[model samples]
Target: MTLEARLAALAAAGQTITYGKLARDLGLRMEELTNALERLMEEDAAAGRPFRAAVLRQRLSPEGLPAPGFFLKAAILGRPAQDPLAFTRAERHALLPFPNIPG
Candidate 1:
């Protein structure tokens, strides 16, 4: 089966997956997975760093946090569509689905 297929099956089972699981499920060694991930990352480097969950910080605590915790969304950089408040008026207008709009 494909890697994505395995990943989807795991996701449907309500289970979280790690690189190790992905590698094992796809009949790949950890090093192979690592190499593939590295190649993907390298390709994305020209378009800003790829967002790897393993590399990105999902949440962070304040410097003086003594309470339960604090959190913020991990950054999704690179693409213009991914950026909020980062478009021209025409660009925003173009995103409207006028054909699907009801009177």
Candidate 2:
């Protein structure tokens, strides 16, 4: 399945995936995955959809959150994530019609 499809499924199931695992699953390098995620973020934003990439997390994330770069990319895309937790929470909530994931 595509990255977005995978993410959508995970989000619908109230689950999250680590960046490393996702990269390995897609047979992509870390950099490539990050690049793809950033592009996805931009596309989602432009389409007025929540970031499907929000279902991604860092391996050692403190709150099951994505790496700091996720926020940085969001900022670059004109969505400044001053509060990372809050931002990610909202994104995940809006990503799917029925969001079962908690912040």
Question: Mind giving the per-residue lDDT tens digits that candidate 1 earns over 1-103?
Answer: 9644453344334233455456777789967765565544344445553223122111242221111110112222233333322322222233233523543
- Model 2 poorest ten-residue lDDT run: 94-103
Per-residue CA lDDT of model 2 for 66-98, tens digit only, reads 888888888888888888999989888877665
Q: How many steric overlaps does candidate 1 have?
A: 0
What lDDT does the true structure give each of the candidates?
A: 0.37, 0.86
Native-vs-model 2 lDDT?
0.86
Top candidate on TM-score is 2
Clashes of each: 0, 0
What is the RMSD of candidate 1? 11.4
Q: What is the lDDT, from 0 to 100, of the residue 31 in candidate 2?
A: 92
Error of 1 at 100 (Å): 20
